[model samples]
Each structure stands twice: as structure tokens, then as C-alpha cells.
Target: MTYRVKDMPACKGCPFYQTGEQGFVPDEINTGAKLAIIAQNPGELEELDGRPLIGRSGQMVIASLGTYGIKREDASWLNVLKCRWQNENILPREENILRGAVDHCTGAYLRQNLARIRPNLYVPMGDLALHWLTGRENIGHWRGSVFIADSGPIRGSKVLPTIHPAAIFRQPAWRSASKSDFSRIARELPKREPVVTYSDVFHLGVSAEEFINTIAALKGPVVLDIETKSTRPKSERKPIEETLAVIGIGWGKDVAANYVCDAALDEVLRAIESADVDWIAGGAFDFTVLTHYGVKFKWERCHDLILLHSRFDIELPHSIEFIASMWTDRAYWKHLTDTDLLLYNALDCAAEWEAWYRLAAFCKARAPLVWKVYMEDRPLIEVQVALHLAGMPTERGRIQAEKRWYEKERETAEKALLAAFGSTQGSATAVPVCATHKRYTGKSPLKARKGEAEVCSTCAAVRRSYIDSQPLNLRSRPQMIRKLRESGIRVPLTREGKTSLAKGVVSKLLKKYNDPRLAQLLNYWSKSTAVSRYFKEAWISPATGRIHSVYSMHSAKHRWSCQKPNMQQTKRPEKVLESLGDIVETAE
Candidate 1:
């Protein structure tokens, strides 16, 4: 029997409907609807029109949906509170009113409608709607992120929380983020199949015999994945702290098994070594962890999915979760038990395997040359992994001393500037005597009118009007220019006739002037920037005593990107360089 809104007995005698206030906005249940959208409440405009979304907010929703080829007439649209309040801000001001409305409306109306429609996907719009449905408060944390709503009107449905269109209009800056969220929804809407779970393919707490039998029956060219405590690789601050939780192996598409890392370590290693081709995502981290755990295998036979994916689209995230979202049809990974980490690993391996083949075919068709180059560079990828494992040497003491030296130099420069300019702490009425005017006056009355009477030789406004005007940091630029002018050297100008403060221009000025103060300021600026970016304590691993930076081999025109104390840009200090000698080589 098909349930209809007209058949619902709760519609009659309802306080909202009885007011003759346009009654309840009945659900527009589209027969083709694979997804349902839940909004906070209908506005006055929607109530007047007797529809779920009819106002500006509704139009925005329709337009956003249209981007994904989803017609407004082809989806179920409902509100948490079925009726709109007469007062526009009544819902937000009176929390109890909304609670009472949801409590009364959902039990009688929403749940019944959901049961009838039974959408595979549920998208809750705005914080209020999301809170009513998911019991979560912060929309910012959950926006565009996928989750399973287990205890609500939309239970057993894949829930994707997104910012409301009204919110986007209120905060214009959120438009880009909202669009991204809509794009994710678009990607997920077409996939309505039940996700293939780990329990379906792998058995946990199995004996060594069971594990061996599971592996032995599997075919060659298997995709492998490992579950660990943390994503960060073994470093000094945190020695290989991540214990192997689960090791998952996928044979072909459907066949897969998960071996408990602690219990079946030996069996897992045996299976990996026996496989003709072992496909892994982030091979360097996984292989290093496995080797650290004393599981020996042939590294030459391993195929890194991350490196391969980078070859095709270097900017795309190569994480297994992201890859699963791209390649798989189901959203099963969103929900899992605490002990199901092994299952998660198994599913990740399956996703990686699927992505590997799809990307291979995609590249071969669209970019055959790129595909060939990637294939030829497979061995080089392995070499890169080895290089990553061998971390760079860092002298903590020398780096700290360099950082201190830069800070002191900057402090000295700042103090000298304060002395020359007579600090901002000086009285507003006291103006410095202009050398041209030879009196404590140049434009005192004009400056006093503007409430900037504390004029100085290095004042940006004064410099711009009466002397050299450059679009550099006013406080430092004027001082640099004054030093150059005092040294009988003309400051270099750009083609636009403005004072040029570019690196090359500044370097030339410094060389010609050879002023100690100018050199000190430049050194201070460079060193301060370096310390903040590269020598932070977070970059050094307390466990390894060396900087273990992760390298992205394809960023910035296919050049390597070094992070975690970016070794690529780490300026060699004399003390450190003298200690390490010629062996201190930067990354290639």
C-alpha cells in the first residue's frame, strides 16, 4: 500500500493547520527521488504559496540542485518544522517553540513521510535542520562532510550536511565553500548502491590456519593496505609509535581478507611476499611501518598507488578515503564499529585497487605519453621512497642560535628606528623640525586638523607628499631610503618612477651603500621569516633527532615539495654546514 500525505490522520486537528494559516506544506515526494533534502522551516513566502521552497531561499536551493542536473520536481523536500511561524525570528528567539514544533511534527508527520519515501540519501540544510536531524550543533565542522545518521527520522540513510543557501547569502565569503559542498553532493547522489563492507569479505579474530587459507586461495596482483594509529610516519619526537592494527589484502574486485596485525603478523607477511604484485597507497610510510614491525618483503615488487595517481593528477588528494569517494559506488565507510579498523583497511585496499585500474585506463586514453613516463619511472618512485625514509640531519642547537641571532638583530633595528624617529609615544602637538623649513613646522596645522600632529622625518604621509614615496612598509622603507639618500646614493626607481623595494633592487642598494644597518635589517627580515616557516619545533621530530619531511614529488611544475621543516628551502647555517661538511646535501 502506497502511503500518501492526505491519508495521515495527524494533518487534521493540528494547531498549525487548524489556524487556517495556509495549513501544512505537504511533501512533494518525487517518485524518482533517490535523495531527500531537509530544511529548517518554510518561510512566510513558502507558507503563502503552500509549498516547501518558494521564496528566494527556495530559488537558491533549486539553482544549486540544478548544477548537479537534479530537478526540483525529482526529489523529496521537507522541513523539520512543517509549518512557518507568523513571526520571522520567532523560531530563533524562542528555542522551546522550535523544540515543541519538531517534537509534535516529526513523530506525527516527518517520520511517517520518511518511511513512505525511504530515500537512500538525506541532505540536511542549515545548522538548525542539521541539529534537529543529527543532534549535532556546529555546522561548520560537519558541513559538506559525509556521515551516517543512525538515530533520527533519517536513520539508515547516508546523511550529508551542507550550509543553507540563506547562510551563504548572509556570509558571501562562504559561497565558494557552499559550492564545493554542493559539488560533493552531486558526486554522491548518483551512487545509491549498498556499500560492500569488510564483514562481508573478511573475518576477524581468525586463527593462523584460517588466515593462511584465506590468503592462499586469493589470486595474484593483490591490493594491500594497513591500518595504523597515526598518519605521520616514524619520526624522532614520535618514534614509530603507531602499532599495526590491521593488514587488509584485496584479490581482484570482490575477494578480500583482513588479517589482525597483532595475531596474524606472520601470515600477513607471508601472503604479501607470495603475491606477484602488491599494490599499496603511500608506499613509503606503509613499507617503513611494516619493515619496522619486522615483516620482510620484496620492496621491488610493490606498486605505489599515490605516485601513480600523482602522475595523472598531481593536485588530487591521494588518500584512500578520498579515492574511495571518487571510485566506489557506496558510502559504507562512514559507519563502522571500534573493532572494525581491519575491515576499514580491507575496504581501503579495494578502493585503491579500483582507482589504480580506472586511472591507468583514463591516462592511457587521454595522456598516453604521461602514462608511459609514469610506467618508466616506477623504479625511480621506489628510490624516492628510500630517500624519504632516510631523513635529513638537523642541528637543533645551531638552528636555535640562528633564530635568536635574527630576533636580536630585528630588535636592534627597531630600537634604532625609534631613536631616529622619536617614537609614536611623543606628544601629538610636538612636530619634528623639517630640515627644509628649519623650524618645528612644515604642515603642522594641516596635520593637527587630521589628528596626526606627531609628525616625524620618517612619517609615511610626509614622505609621500614632500619627499620619496614608495609602496613599501612605511616604518622600514623610509628609514632605508633615508640611509641611502644620506650615503649620497640615489634610490633605484621602477619604470613607474616609484622607489623599487624588490629583492634585486634592494640587493643592489645594499651592495652600493654597504651600510651595516641596511644589511642588518635585510638579514633580520630573512632570518625571521625562515625561523617562523622552517625551524619551528613542530617540524623537528623528538623521536628521530632529525627532520623527517614528507615530499610531494609532483607539486610546483612537477618539482619536489618538502614539508615538516621544508628541507628544500632550509638555509644552511655556517655552524651546521661546518659540522656536517660536504655530505650535507639538499634534496634533488
Candidate 2:
């Protein structure tokens, strides 16, 4: 079954044939091998050697197999495009030409090869090779999961698409993810599609009594989730309750019941509260919103999958979709939110239930102490949920007064700076000198280390003058950098020589420089930024005139993150206390 150039007349008409490159790299077909590794196209070395997967990337793939005790000779190797698509200059051809080449070559060689050397496992590296094998793109979403293809050259084979080794070379963070995929491949789990049996009991004429009874009958650990019309309650004089669109409750692995919110609201709440142990994905919103509907639960009985996931990998995303991708065999269905609401919610409950056990087991086995700490801190979700709903009472009049005062201060600083140095009306190029007396180049390293380049004083003043003449806002990175430079403040650069203006950098610069203009600029920037941010975060409830900000315990390690009105970043706590003096009468 060796594919020779003379045996392939179809390749002569391929888009890559015009490049006059070396002959097609023949597939290293190992008949009866359980695994087949497919790559996008032949690299220069692969093409010259007239063999598929002979380059560095191919070796990395082979080494991953070796980690699982699978030798190189045990798996067949292939390339979607047999010949190299790039020319001698290493420049890829036009988009249409590349697509045409991939289409032509995959059909000509890959399919026939698969038929002869049928593999139980198919590993497609990169998107092009993945699309050829499974007719799917975006390897990021498809990778690390075994996909059972319905129809393709490698149909019915367990296809595991992973990040290309070349991609891992560019982004080293992907290496860990690639290793996870390799580990899954080594396990060689059976190919079985994930299934969830969902019943719309409310719409199907099932009584509310039956729904509650079903939930009560289930063994401990019920997963609860709710879809709502609005994330928060609409504050009004009469206390507007949060509207629930659908309530999803699932027990065990396969059964999930989705009930539309109507007369069954009380029953839905009862079913949720009756469960001895409940599993939820970020239950902060679900529990908080339920409180508005007069539903309360024993917080100790609840488990948040998001918090459980953080124990395993704190930095990785802890969303239900991300967790499910790792633990459950379910396909990606979050996109179905637009088309089918009930089914999407049902799928979410099923994913939550399934991912919870796997995540719990993984944490218990690998990091028992971490799991213990997570369990101890798990009850803190209740505290956070309560704090969010309780909210901070603030005077609308005081907020407006502070905002106006900051705006006036910003105007005063802007005027002083402009008056001292005349507005830059004409073009003036900045001969920006680095802080260490080095020349500024686009390729300069961002770090302000011993040899790294940074913004200079002269360039900073000149840039400030130009920005002062125009509208002022820190909306864009370039504008913010221009402002920072003009103020005679040293702005840090990233490795790619791009502006790195994080809050920490700004704070450090403010303390490092004592120049009057730098002080003025800081005053202007701080006031302007605070005023804008305050207004944006100021979503005060009309009924209580309080900010019900969302809070999270898992976003940061051993710390909480607040959003909406971020109370943590409040600059003047003394001022806030003084404002609340009237509410709390002073005792003599």
C-alpha cells in the first residue's frame, strides 16, 4: 500500500504542484497499528526525507507516545498534505491555494491510507489536520477530548485532536494542556457518547407534586441550576423579585428535569431545598437570586463545582463548560443557548452533576490537603452570597458631589499643565531616550531590568503637551501610554516593546517620581479614572439606595474579588465612614 509519485496522477494537478517541490511524503503505514498520528503538512525536512512526521514536531508526538509505553513503530504516521505547501522562502501560498491543496491531497492519499491501515485511535495535530480527519476547525475547543466521528476517512475511530507541537513552541503554556491530551490518549478509554435524559415535566403535563417527589426520592447530592431573565433583581419600592426563566435539577448522571418558572416556582424551590446535598456551578447567583423568591437553603449542604475545580488548578478557568470539557464526555453545547433554552439548561445540570464527582475524586487522590482546605473554605460561599445581597448603603447625593469634585480637580490640573507648557499645536516627533541612556527601539525588551529600555523624561513632557491639546481619556492603550509619557512618568514596556500600564506599574511610578508635572498628571489621571469608574459601577438599587455588587471567593487565591461597585479599591474609607456618621449615632 506504499504511495509512489508514479502511482499518484491526482497530485500533479494539486495547487502545491506549481511550486515544483519534492515528491509527496509517503505515509509510514504500520498495518494493524492501534494508533495513527496525522499532521497538517510536510515540513522542509519531512518533504526532503520523503517520509511523514520526520521533523521536530513529529518527534515530540512520538516522545509523548513513548511516555505511555507506546513505541514509534506501533503507530502509523501521516500528513494531511503529502507535499510541503510553503515554497523555498518558507512563505505559505494564498488561502484558496492552500485550501485547494489540503482538499486535493487529503482525498488523494489520506483516505486510501486510512482504509488500508485502519487505526483504533486517530491523533490529528493542529486545525488543518483536525478538519481533514473530523471536518471540524478550532483545535482549541476540540483538543483534549475524544471525538467519535460520524463520517470521515477516520470515521468511527477515537479522534483526539491536540495542540500542535509548533503551537506549544510559540506558547509554552499550551505544553501542559498537550500533555493532558497525551495522557488521555494513553488511557485508551472506550468510545461512548455522553447522554442526558431530560424531561420538561411542567410542559409535559406533570404536576408540581410529582416534580418535588421525584427530587425527594433521589439519593443525596442533587445538582441545582436556574436560568433567569435578569441576573439581578430590579429594585423598586415594593421589592421586585428576580424572575426565574427555567429551573434545572438533576439527580445521578442521566436524569435531569427542567421546569419552566410559573405556578411550579414554590415546588422548584422545595425540591432544591429538600436535597440533602446539592452540587452547583458557582451557586452565588443561583442562591442569591433564590433568596429574593423567599427560598432559603442550608448552606453547609451545598457544594460548588467551581470552587472544587479551583483546588485542582487554581489558575485554569473554573467555568462549568471548561470543567465539563475535562471530566465529562459531553459535547460542547453552550452555543445551543440561543436556539434551545431548556435543553441547554438540562445539559448544564447534567454536566455539573457529572463533573462534580470526577473533580472531587481527582482532588481527593492527588492533593488531599488542598481538597481538605477547599472543603473547609467551601462554606465561605454562603458568606459571599450574603454579603453581595446585603450590599453597601450609600448616599446618591454624596456620590454625585464626590464625582463633581474630582472632575473639577482634574480640570484644574489640566489647566495648570497646559498654561505652564503651551499647547502642542504642531507636530513634534519624540526622540525618546531610554531611562538607562539607551536608544528606544520597537524591539526593546519591556522589563525595566538592568539592560531593558524604558520611557524617558524629555519624551514624556513632549508627549504630554500633544495629548493636552486634544480630548483626554484612558480608553485606549496608546492614549494612556501617551498620557503617562507626557507626564514625565516612566511607563514599563512588555517583552514585545508594547506599553504595559497596569495599576501596579502606575502606582510604582507615582511613588518613584516627585516632579510637579508628574504629580499634576497623577491627580488628573486618578480623579478622571475614579470618576468614570465610579459612575460605571454605581448601579444602586432604587429601593434601598445600596450597591448589590457581585463577589467571588475563587477568582483570587485566598482573597475575594468584587465587581459592579468594587468596594475593595475604595480610596478613602475614612470619608465613607464620615458619610455614614448620620446613620450611626455617635455615643458620648
Candidate 3:
């Protein structure tokens, strides 16, 4: 049975009614909304207008929803407390009063309304409503997060908590975060097709001769995929001596073939080479790996799915599994076996072909300019592959010497710090009592006389004198904070009030402050971080006597990324280039 507010009588003795104000019932209460929005309470304007949300807060909601192609009428609006009490003193403050009202309203009205509407999603806004709905205290922790409502009439429905529009109006800082949350909701709400499971394509596995014949018969573009033993380059401790495992090829939807990449390798390579256009998910990685295995092909006609999809939606995940989930209805293969692996690879090729057609159509219809840019950037994928194949040479002696120098410099800095602050009580390291540390002792070091309290050795005045100081430890958060404080800069924080020390944040901070010490520290930190992260003993290729990193063109920005001794992020670019001059000449 459908329920409406007119069928039930209003409470008479409630504070909202006693205040000589009329009770409000939303006009579209029984409109059967698929999405429900639960708010804290009604404002004075809402009470007068006889609607749940018609105030400034409602306008914000309307505007945010409009950005994502949703109208205000698309969702049902309800409040945690049904009654409107403008006076703060008359509002329900005691737990018993609030709980009683919630119990009465939920049992009498909310349950029946929910049963009639059966909303797929519930969005709870503000502290009171969000907490009462989810039983969580910290609204900040729950905001912008999706959770399953376990109890009440909204059980089994997705609950996305967000800050109230009223809060955003009061605190402008929350505007961006609220908009981001709304954007995420929009992405998650789009309808999708049912997932496609394993098909009958595996039964079409062909012999080497059959594969050659099948490829020669194909008239259109072919989707290609290769399964390898390891995606990483050959390292000293764990070298990937054998690369290719299975070669999967798809010529249209149902017609697909896979061959064990042992005896039939040459025939498969010949078939791939003969194809007019080869579509690969990560073309750079695959092409470079094939080059290493003594199979070279001109990558002029290669259409990289990674680059194409990145051009369309840079933020979406570009992994084959993720892209398949987004574009196609394919269910990801769960089992891990040789046969399953081959089938997975084959299905990926099929999905790639389908995804390409969809993206091509989308670009042609909506964004012709973007399509042109993608085509122009297509040849650069081959250039990236070439760079990866030409492994960078390293001077082991110079690397060792630089490492030693940094170690000595760090030790000297630590000794100086110890002399400035004195050793910590019963501890090996010296810790200064700065402004932040003084909070623990309830003292202000800045208010204290000179030399009375332990002053920060890296204060603004002192740091300016040592403007060319290099960072000894790049990974140390405390050290980075000290450096920022000494340079009279505020640390960047996220919306949730946590420190944001990302590279972009640091880069902006350096540009704003323009302090030589901070600039030098950042440069040294970048180089030191690259050296420590990538230039390790296990990363060296024993067979080649040079570091060979696995490169992929499937990055979000269509740029190359190197893994396992990342040569793309060298410590000193000029030094490494000079050392690799002979190798570069040979490669050229």
C-alpha cells in the first residue's frame, strides 16, 4: 500500500507545534524516488515554504546535482527530525528525546515510505543525520565514503555520507570536497550491462599452421596479447630468463586463437607482423619485451588501448581488468592456471577490440579535436618503446662515490644538530623542543628568553644563512616539516586535516617560498630518492651489465613509466647520459 503524509495526523504537543509554527510535509513524499537524501532538520525558510529543502542549502544541493545531470526531483528529501525547531533551546538535545522521536517517526512513517519507494541509494548529510543513520560519531571520517546500511528500512542500500550543504555555505573550504564527493557519486551511479563470463572462444585454440592461416585470412584490424613469465626485466637475484608463455590473438569477437609460445613462436610472430594494424593494451611494454626476445617489428600501425582510453578518461584505471569492467560486461577470471591465463589473455584481446570501437565512436561524436590529438601522439608510443629497449648505462664507481658523500654529509649534519640541541635524555638522537614540541609541556618557546628553552636549530633566520643546505633524508616527514617551518611556510593539509606531502604540494610550496635552502633540499631529495628507490643491487641486469627497467605506455598521462630499476627517474640526468654515450651511439 502507498503511504502519504496526509493520511497520518500530526503531533500536537511537540515543541515545533507549540512554537505556533505549522508542520511541513514534502510535496513529493510519495513520488517513488530511486535515490533518498536524508538531512538534519528543516530551517525557518523551509518550515514557512512547507517543503523539506527550499533554502540556500537546497540550492547548493540542486546546483551540485545539476552538474552531474541529476535534478532535485530525482531524489526524495527527508530529515532526521521531522519537526522544525528554530530556537536552539527548544531543539531535542537529550539522547532520550532524540531517540524517542527517531523511533516514533521511523516506525510510524519512514518504514512505510521506504517500502513504497525502495530507493537504491541513501545519501545522509550533516553530523546529526549522518551519525543517527550510520551510528558513527566523527562525520569527517564518514564523509564522502560509501557504506552499506545494515539496519533500519534502508538496509541493503548503499549509503554515501557527505557534508551538509548548510555546512558548505558556512565554511567555504568544504566546497571543493563536497563537489568531489558529488562527482564520485555520479560516476558510481551510472547504469551498466551485466558482466560477461568465459565464452566459447577458448575451444578455437589453433595450431601454429592454423594460426598462420587464420591471420592471413583476416581483413580488418587484429587485437593481440602476449603472456609472459614475468613483466619485470631480468635482475641479478631473480632473472626472468624465459619471457613468452602464451600468445593470444583475436580476429573479431567469437573467432580467437591461442598458441603455446614455445615451438610455434616464430610462426606467431610472422602472423602478427603480417597484420595491417595491431591493437595492444600496453604496446611499449609488449614491444620492448618482444624486442629483447629477438623479435623486432615496426610499431607504426600499432593502436595502443592504453593511450586511447587515457585520452578519453585520464582518471579511470587503465588496467586490462579494470578497463574491461568499465567498458565491457566481462566478468574477471578468478582462477589462476595455465589454461585460465591463456583464456584471460584471449578475452582481454577481444575486450580491447570492442573498447576501441566504442571509444572511437564516442570521440567522433563528441570530441573530434581530442581524437586528432590522440592520433598525433600515437607515434610517440613507439619512441617510448625505443627508449626502453636502449637501456641506460651506469658508472658504478661514480654512484658509489656520490652515495658515500651523501652519507658523510648526513653524519656531519646530525653531529651539528646534536651540538645545537644537546642529546635527548637517555636517547641516541638529539631532539629539539620547538613550538610544536612545547605544546606537550604547556610552554611557549617563543615567549621564553634566549637560551632558556631549547630553540629549533633550523629556525627561519638560521635556515636563511644556510640557504644551500641539501636534504640528507628525503623520506623523513619530521625533517621535511622542520624544513618547512624553518622557511616560515605552512604545511599543506587535506580536507580531512591530514598533512599532504605529495610531490605536487612540495613543488608548489617551493615555488611560493622560493627559498634556496628549500629548493636545494628538494632537488637533492628527488635525486637521492630516485637513487635509493631504483638503483639497488637486485635491480642490475647481470646478463647486460646495465640496468634494464620494464617500461609501460599505459600510464594515465600517456607518459612512460619504468619499473624494477626505473631508469626514467635517474639521480643525475647529465651524468647518466654522459656515461651511456657509448651505448646510445651503438643503439643509434
Candidate 4:
């Protein structure tokens, strides 16, 4: 069925639209089907085909469904906007126009379409569809999470969001994640709506006596988590500063207890140190922060959910929100107000506690060896905390000097680049091999072709002329391909058919062509970036007076990865290292 402009009477006079009829793509509905799929709008092919979900994106969704035993005809398909939002060139329209179109269409069509179909389950593809359903964005965080609405056109329907198949073209990594979401949707279709029964037994703002009494009486394993005051302005002076604000503890399946970190602190610590196993999500962070503040507890009594979950399902996110969404019916609370910090913290503990048990039982039943491996590796959490405390000692003066040196190098590089490329203030006299004659920005150096004596002119435009008759952005893949081809070098294309200028591709090009200009271009591009990284990294932690890098044993290969200034990839300055104390190596 073709939807015409006449059908959407309200959209006829909208200023946002430039084209007519070619934009409208009608929905393909399987009436009374249990499932429905929604995308933001029609792509070029989708609009031309005059049907939703017939393009590449639809094909990917269908292919994914095939792996899960779901047929293409099993679900209805629709889009938020019946019309295409892009202009004649296929570029997105102005932001205001885009927003206006979405507002008008969703209000005039999407809601009504959803209400008309009224499927039991809805799979909202990508961020726009997600925002329409839940008023939230960032598909990365929300994907694979089940959201049940109680009030919109989608009310009473369970919506599972997944990244759009088109996202794989730009972010190849999300390909696996997109497939995982479809798997989840398939698994959820047959099951009843996940009923989240968060323990209503929340004890907030209890008295000191009550806090101690609760901690003392706790039996069996408990989930522990803490809320800290972010030392923001003060953080500039003290990078690793964190003050304990609230402690959330969960013992019973339906109970959560939170205490203000006040007068009864010592009693709470001693009690926790002596209690049964404490399940914690991201225990390395919590433990390190507590130890930084001089609070000590038994590491043997703690189980890190991050490590355990990664052992079996490393591909999936192990965040409390992601975990809760998978195992429990806990609503995504990260977006909710944090004014009630204790309540939020308590709920987190509750979710962590619930997810921990669910994940453990799953590992035990399906992958007993994984469960055993986690138990064996659990002791390493203690060693990691100790290493965090034993930070690398640095000579303060030498560290300051090192920073100054990088700053000086950046200044010198900038001056040299400015001298090499004429300021972006003039017209090019001639075009270079790159084909486009464009204005030159004195920001970076453009390497001269072979045998062209490295010209050191105040105006880099002399060399820029040889590159393009029209001004060209060297950073652009198309422009680079043209430039390489002009130089008799055949540029390779990515699997997506775009020009491949990836590091590996460029490296291969350099070896095959052995062009000195290519080598100079690579070095010039990386030089400033390498110098700039000195400021971005977490160089030193004031609390430890040393470099305390975070090491993790969670990867596809199970190889150890270090972050927060990845020490594995970095090398300390010789002078700085000479001034440092002996390394405190932890036993693997």
C-alpha cells in the first residue's frame, strides 16, 4: 500500500519537506502478529521501493532472525517517519528541519501506527526508535535491555532495542553486539514479560545504632556497594580523591540496607571483614577506593561479579544496568534522578545481588569449568588492590620537566608546520596531483612529492598547488584516494567499498610504493597526536604518589589488559623510572 501526502494531511504544509511522494514508504504489516519492528525512517532504496524493511538494513534483520528460528513473515515492520528526511544529495537535512519532521511525523503517524498494530513485543532498531519508545538515547548502553512501557502508544508492550544494521558500516565492532540483541529478542518472545520484583525492604537513613545492628546481624553472603562524593573542583589537586558517602548492603532476596558513612564506620568495617562472602560488581574500583581512604576489609570474603561474568560471557556488557536488565526486571535507573543517592545505591546493591546469584547459577549449570576457574582467579582481586595502593613513586620535579618538554616539542612542531604550509589566508596559484585546488590551513605539514626539494617557505600553498586544482581536504578518504591515484598508486577499498586508509592499508601502501612523501605524511600526522597524548592520560595518582594502572584479565584471548594509562603500551621516561622505587609485582 502506498502512503500519499494526502494521507498525512497535517504534513502537507510542513516547511521541513522539500520532496513529495518519493519520501513516503508504507509499512508492511502482518496483522495480529505478536512482534513488530520499528526503524527511524526510510533509506534511499527503502523510499524508492515504496515499502519499509526491503533495503540492506531489513535484509540484515531478516538474516539475524533466520539464525534464531524466526521467519521474516513472523513480524510486522514499520518506521517512525513514512517519508525520507535526507535531501537530494542524500545528506541529512538541517537539524531543525530533521527535528521538526520527527516531531510532526511521530505525533501524526508513528504513535497511531503502533496503536493500530498493537503488537505484544516491539523491537525498536537504533537510537531514534529507542528515544521514541523510552525517551532515552545511546543504543550502546540500552541494547539488549528489556523495557516495558505502561503509558504510551507502546504501553503494555515489551520493547527490546538493538543497533541498526547500518551501524555496522561505521562501527564494525557493533556487528556482533547487534546479533546478540536479536538472539535476546528471540529468547524473550516465548517467555512471559520479565517481572522485576526488586526488594521493597529498603532501610534508608538509619541511626548509627541501627546501622551497626543491621551489619552485625547479617548472615550468609551479602552484596556490597558504595556511593562516593565526587571531589570535582578539588579533584584537580587530588586526582584519586573519593569520600565514602553511603554503603548499600543486601543480604536477603527481598531486603536492602543503606547506612550513612558516619559514627559507626569502624564497627561496620569489622563486621563486613568477618561476614560471609560479599558479592560486588566492579569490586576492583570499590576495593581500591576504600583502601585509599584507609578502610581495610577481607578480600577473600568478596566475589567480583565483573570477573565472573566476563569469564563466561565476555562479549556482553557486565555493567549493573546491563546485568540487571538481563537477569532481573530492574528498570534502567541510571537516567533517573540521583537526588536520592542512598535509594539509588540501595537499588544497585539489590540488582547486583540478584544478578550475581543468577549468573553464578548459570555458570555452574552450563559451564562448571568456568565457575571453577573464577573461584581460582578470585584471589587475584586482593593482589590487584594491593598494587593499586602501592603506586609507582615518581620524582615530582622530573615529572614536571617531562610535561614541559612535550609542551615545548608541540610548540616547535606547530611553528615548523606553519612555516611549511602557507596560512589559510590566500588563493592557491596552482593545483597539485590531489586534483582539488583548496585553501591551505597552516595547521599541518603537506609533504612535497619525491625530488621536489622539501620547500621551507612561509607559504605552504606553493606545495598545496601541486596537490589539487580545487581545494581538497587531505584527511578525506576520497581526496586521499584521488591523490594516491594521481601519483600512480592504486588505493585499496574497504569491504564496504569505501577507500581503505586504515593503518594497515597505509602501511602496506608505504611498503609497496616506498614513497618518501608517504613516509613523511605518516610521521607528520602522528607526531602532534603523540605529543598531545601526554596531557590526556592519567599520569599520576596523588593518593599513591605513583602510577597505579588498572590491570584486567578479561579479553577475547583472556590476555591481561591494563588501562587508566595502559602501562603495557607505554614506557616510563628513563629519568622518571630511575627516580622511582622498586616495583611491587603481584603473583599471577
Scored by lDDT, the top model is 2
Full ranking by TM-score: 4, 2, 1, 3
TM-score of each: 0.58, 0.67, 0.54, 0.76
Candidate 3 local lDDT, 265-362, one digit each (tens): 77678767766555554455666666666656656667777777777766555655445444544433423345577667777677676666666778
Clashes per candidate (backbone, < 3 Å): 6, 5, 1, 19
Clash pairs, candidate 1, are 236-542, 236-543, 236-544, 237-541, 237-542, 237-543
List runs of model 4 lying over 4 Å from the truth: 1-11, 29-31, 63-74, 87-93, 148-158, 168-199, 218-220, 233-239, 252-254, 411-530, 539-544, 567-588
Tens digits of per-residue lDDT, candidate 2, 186-263, equal 776333332222332222223567666777777767788877775544332111235777777766555687777777
| Runs with alpha carbons beyond 4 Å of true place in candidate 2 | 1-32, 39-59, 78-117, 126-138, 151-157, 165-177, 189-206, 230-242, 278-282, 392-546, 564-588
Candidate 1 vs candidate 4, TM-score winner? 4
- Tens-place lDDT per residue, model 4, 1-588, is 545454556677554454344457767788877789998887756755678888888898898898988887788898877775422313243677767777787777677777677666788888878887777778777777777766556776787888888888667756756766777778777644843334378898777678767877766678888777764542232214567778778765557888888977777766656655554645577777666766567677778878887787777666677666666556566664357787787777777887788878899998999999899988888777777667657655555555554556556654554344333322446524332323334333454321245643533654455443445443455665666676688988778777777657878899999976565445544544444443355466655567665667666666777665555443444554443333211110
Reference-based lDDT, each prediction:
0.61, 0.68, 0.60, 0.67
Query: Any idea what lDDT model 2 has?
Result: 0.68
Q: Please report how far candidate 1 places residue 572 from its true position, in Å.
A: 3.6
Model 1 lDDT at residue 13: 48
